[model samples]
Target: MSKRTAIIDIGSNSARLVIFEKTSRYGFHLICEQKSKVRIGEAAYEKEGYLQPIGIKRAYFTLKSFLHTIDKYQANKTLCIATSALRDAPNGKEFVQWIQKELGLSIKVIDGNKEAKYGGIAAVNLLPISEGISIDIGGGSSDMTLIKHGYIVDTYSLDLGTVRLKELFFDKGVNPSEINEKAKAYIQHELEKLPEHFRHTLAIGIGGTARTLSKGIMKQVAYPLDKLHAFTYNVSEHRSYLDAIPLSSAKNLKRFGLKKNRYDTIREGTLIFNEILSHIGTETVISSAAGVREGVYLEQLLKKDNLKFPSRINPSVTSILDRFQPLVNIQKNQKTKRKLASNLYTVLQQDINDNKQYEKELLWAVKLSSIGQTLTVYRSHQHAFYIAMQELNHGFTHEEILLISFLLRMNEKELLNKPLFTHYKPLLPEKSTLLWLSFIYTLTVLLQEASNNAGITFTYTNKTLRIISDKPLYLAKEKVKALEKPIPFAIIIEDESTLPKNKKLGI
Candidate 1:
């Protein structure tokens, strides 16, 4: 694979191009994304899967514009694939040949099963999910893949799609309730053929319809974070809202916060999604921003090492560190800092009333704590906070991202930012837990700054923290004295008697 790769996916409803730039052997990020609602499969379902001239013109112009972007980015490689629309069309091969001759671009028409597998690959690698059913409801077909233990187990695609249903029922001059009954019955008939083993507790939603619905749910519930990639909700809790989309009139979609552009097909998409969720016994729905484009890119990127990212490797983290970290290796003592932080967290668990649930997040914070220094030493915590919030995007839950960002924002004077904490309180752990994690993180940073390789030990008893070191820690002692504590705790530094035993250290 080249350093830069562009992936073009032509679905039934729209066409999209995403360019990914690799930062390292195993790290990559999307640099550019463009989409056009070509609706290439328009009127095709009604005409026995024949491509209409109107749809062809729209798709041709979209592809031509996409090529201009591909040139602008100088993408080293381009992978193009078409689903449902072309695969079902009788003259699909003729269109492919026409595009190739005119635009010098090759388009591979993938089967429904391959489409489902692509979505599954994307969900398994990008989202923090191990077992679930990946559902991608496109314009002309709904693709599904069963994932177990972080691998795709089986893939199935149904003829049921938003555009297909819309053309067959919603767009017809029939009664609204009649359309609903017919559409439901049609979706049920298609779902009846799904394997019984596809039923699962979790459902990963991919593609445009899922994203649009997730955005509405986020606004309705006043979700703090605006990110949609990992936004999750209980299927049972939102059943009413999910069921109401199909029932709502076109003129009334604005009340539900749906965009005007999606008015034509959202109802159809939601209806298909709801019926599928009901069929698969899904209790939870996790929205994913990645879909066929990402999966297609990753398929080539990780082909040598199987179709999954290596265990314990987070692409977002690695990409950020690779791009932002100083080449001089400013954080040479990172390993030592992690050790000290881990020790403090473990020893202070009883005092903070924690069960090591956030230990992984704390360690991630430690690794990225110094990255902000590359920008400027003054107010580096703020820089780090912003970077972690923006860059810790993939392979993490909303709660984990918020926690890691909060940990990176701590300073010596204050362990808690009350206003910021209040804003994200709904997604974060208890205030007391956060305060302790911040304190541990700040102290570890201070210790690492004072002595890169000091032999240090920690002990906590009777509301007192004892820091024992082999050599004098004059700077660490002074810094520790001024630091804020989550709870009322005294500090006794046994570092070559740097401080008097009677000195007060608790706040």
Candidate 2:
């Protein structure tokens, strides 16, 4: 356990604060969060690109509330940052200073490039973006970052946002051809300014614009809420959908299923997205739920750890996995055991079933758990756990990494357990853990195939476990320990040294 921290992101269209529960001495939890659509970019871009007094007041009020929330949580540290809206405003600095004085909240107004970086870093934390561009179209500006192999190669903030376009062109809600023309020109100019080397085969979407579109798609198709995670959309289909949502009623539009609050900005967001696609010649979009706030969270982790990024990877994942790398060791030895354990808990699925992805995740854990061991020797289990959690750089949730490590530990001990391992029971319930543990706590002698490491062999007979052997059983003793745990159960060991007879040994 570690101190909790709070992060506040003041974007062009909205403001939000999330309290991240620090998991390890350095890990973070997206414990809880709150958001509001303040339209600061609308205010900034409306009056010749200056922060309007009204917008400033709105932001001040929002920050005041966020500060109270953080205070309520007893968070030890806080950071507030403003993006495109403030960068476009002449009075942005003054507004920040005012907030600093009025609510005792210091706000840092960052430029567009930094905003893009934060967005890209957050995306990298979720899915590996091998090569792509990220576009976050806000109320007043669109941020673009070119990423190749998980690194930010270039960034540009274009002065083209949904609110700004609506204000500049849609006089009395008319589709001003000139506005569209200017938007295209602005986007093209910004794109041209980007390094020619940054063109990508893929594109990642972040910010409110992309998020709102994903929600709209979900509403349009009646998608189930559960798989709303990392949703993917075709650029053309999204563009067509945006085209269907006529411009006039965009602000007060009623799309039946979607939240009313998000209606106004979607049109503008869609327009900007279409233009970005045109500029980059990309027809793909991967929407990410994580953005600057998570980036801020990752930044805090790296700074605290003093961890260096591998020359190849974004430092964000490095800092993240450093706290969870110990869990990958038992992937091979514990999987079938895990599957056996999982089988025992099938009847309980009425209460706690897993997703289709869960088993794959478990299998992945089994394969990767022992990656650190040069050989399957005495301390290999311990070495494997260390490598999985500490040496590996695979981007995973801190919780996921820890859970895998906890499962890996199940394969090493005799009598099926250790005390520190119990902390997991609260998270993974007793039935599930025991089933997984019992399956893993299998004797190699009884399951003779595993003795010569010929291969892993497993079978169960109404609470009894067995393994077929390929060698003499004398060397099978140490391997038996991994198979014997949480007992008052049954065990059987057979070897050629024992005169070719089926035997039974129960403990």
Candidate 3:
């Protein structure tokens, strides 16, 4: 794979270009992305699927502009794939050849199965989902893939989409009731083509319709985090709103917290999405920021690695660490902190209740604890917290991401910030669990800093925490004495060799 690669996805509703820069093998991030609402299948659906001049002109110009942006970035390689729009169009091949002849670009027209597989690959690799049906609803087709145990098991595509339905029913200017009744029956008829096995309780939503709905739900519920990827909501809770979208008038979309740009196709998209969810027995929806573009990139990037990232490797985390913590010693130091934190957590596990469950998050927090120090030493905790909140995005749930942020934000003076905690309280673990993890993480970091990277051990008994070190931890004793405890507990520091013991009073 090239060091810098650009992926172009031409869909019925839009054409998008994304540039990804690799920092390491299996470590990459999006450097730039551009999209145009070409609606290439604009009037083609009603004309026996013939590419019309209006939509063809829009797509041709969009692709031309995209190439300019790709050249500006000097992307080493470019891969372009066209989805439902081009595949369903009678002149799709002519358009592809025309682009090759004129703009020196080649576009691969993928069938519905390939489109669904791409979506599945992206969702499985990027989102924290093992089993679900990845749905990519476009302007002319609804592609789906069944993912189980981190692999795509099956894929299928239906001749149902927003633009297809809009042109078939909505644009006819029929009354909303009659249009919806006709659209629902038509959608159901198309959904019957889906494989009987393409059902799951969780749905991985890909593309614009899913994202728009997720954003609106976030606004409706006042979700704190501004992120769209991996944002999850229960279908039963929002079923009414989903059903109401297609019936909403253009002027009333704002009540659902929708943007005007999406007003053109949001209704049809929502109708298709809602019907599909019901058909597949979907209970939850996890929105994905990645789709065919990312899938196309990853398919090529991980071709040698079985089309999946190596086990236990998260691309986002690897990319951040590769960029920020380049030195071996700094990485070694993080490892050292992780070891100490793990040891402390084990010793104190019996007393912290179910906090043992958060040990994974604790380890990740420890690994990334020092990244902010590279930016500035003063108040690095806040910097680390912000970075974790933003960069620890892919392959992580919202709760896990928020928990890691709170862990990274730990400081000696404060165990937990009240305002910050209160703001994201709903997305976090219980107060007790968070405080325990924070206490353990903060103590481990303090010990490593004060001991000058010396060996350490821990043993907790009878409501007292005992830390034994290979050398005298003089700085550690004072820090421990002034530390804030999550619960009523005592901490004692012991020097390994001979000397009067330094008695540290626990707070």
Candidate 4:
């Protein structure tokens, strides 16, 4: 049976509640989310770390509203966590007790190290990077985790959140240049205490600051895809844009397409991120939309299994299948198609170097190839392409999602030559590479559907490719021939009937 649970994370800058509907024992997806920028840490740092009455009231009402939402969803469990602000405040425990007595809600105020661990958990489980540094910049503190081989090796939480910095310096009407220098000095001081091994080439950014910066960059580049999670950029390539952010005025920030709600703290966030990149010597940053709240959900979900992370399960694909449950039978059609595609890819791989890394994506495409048929049988591939592009959210980079979508839509050669293909060319692999993979996918589908009680095998030589089937194959050769763009190799197909009666096919 499925279960509904809500995770509420009250940060120094904002309070957010995310409700996840468990689709299976190990699969779940975000069903509802809400956030309020209460700035709970506003002036608290300047005032001896006390929760201001106004901020307290704001957070109380936000939680009250969240309770209503939780009730509406019938969430059987709610995990409420407070980070930075509540944990650092002198009255933090008092406030927790007050909320428990008055609002009938239990709140756990986690320390910095635990906060950092949660951020790492979310990134390591969801994002593509297995070894990197994960950073979550909140309003009051910044959490950094060193991930090695999909596990957290070390964690550090710096008292350098955007809102915390804004309160310390920027809110005092200081010049942008002066604030930038002071913030940089402070950040350098904190980061210098960390061990050198924590500085990694790849940085997975989590929380609102990273998400907002990703949006601004996306707008600047006119990124075709609108998804925020897994959006990546090379730090060196975009250094100037990051540098210009602290000096950008509110009007300019708006012109740059930053969200209005984020305008107040974005400059501080950018400066902090700039300092972080400088300190770590990060090369590339992949933005993640999941953070502490998602991490909390994962904790609850994985507790019974005596595991901290799901083993080799792509949450994004599992969630998609759970929601759609495509008409294709998993044990029969989809599994067979995937097996054939894998076998063909293995044989074809001898001639290709760059396409080897695409094995995971190819498998995802084959698994979801028939999902569009649920929408409409006519032009189902097109529908499937749209669905994959728009809805396959987690565990994939934008390029991977786009490639899978294009591969799924490849029923004819014209689809590859369309204007849409050119528009997304930057995100796609080389045209020849795409054609090879798509051709393999097409052949798998056709061969899987063409004959029953038939086994397919592929053999390749320097200049020729041969396909052998254990049963008589009656597929239209023209369909296969159409995929031969410039014909990389000569092709031949044969059936078991053509072999001598005394001879047996090699396995």
Which of the two, 2 or 3, has more TM-score?
3
- Return the TM-score for each candidate structure: 0.96, 0.65, 0.96, 0.90
Task: List model 1 lDDT by residue over 1-507, tens digit each.
Answer: 799999999999999999999999888888999999999999999899999999999999999999999999999999999999999999999999999999999999999999999999999999989999999999889999999999999999999889999999999854667789989999999999998998998999998899899999998899999889999999888889988889888888898887888999999999999999989999999999998988998899899879988886899888888877766445557788889899999889887766888999999998888778889989989998998888888899999999999989998988999998999999999988898999999999888778647778889988889987766788787789999998888998876465456543331
Off by over 4 Å in 1: 328-332, 496-507
Better of 1 and 2 by TM-score: 1
Q: Which residue pairs show backbone clashes in model 1?
A: none
Residue-level lDDT tens digits of model 4 in 1-507: 239888899999999999999887667888899989888877899899999999999999999999999999999888899999999999988999999998999999998889988888888778877888888888988889999987889999888898888888777764777777887788889878777887888998898888988888899898877788899999988888888988776567777678998888999898888888778889999999888887777777776754354666777777777776565546577677788889888888777656577988888898887787777778888888888877787777888988898888877554375676888888988887887788777777767767674777889887677878778776645566665442467877777667666655654
Q: Which ranges in model 2 have alpha carbons more than 4 Å from their true place?
A: 175-192, 222-225, 237-239, 246-248, 251-257, 303-360, 365-466, 469-507
Q: Where does candidate 3 stray beyond 4 Å?
A: 326-329, 496-507
Best by lDDT: 1
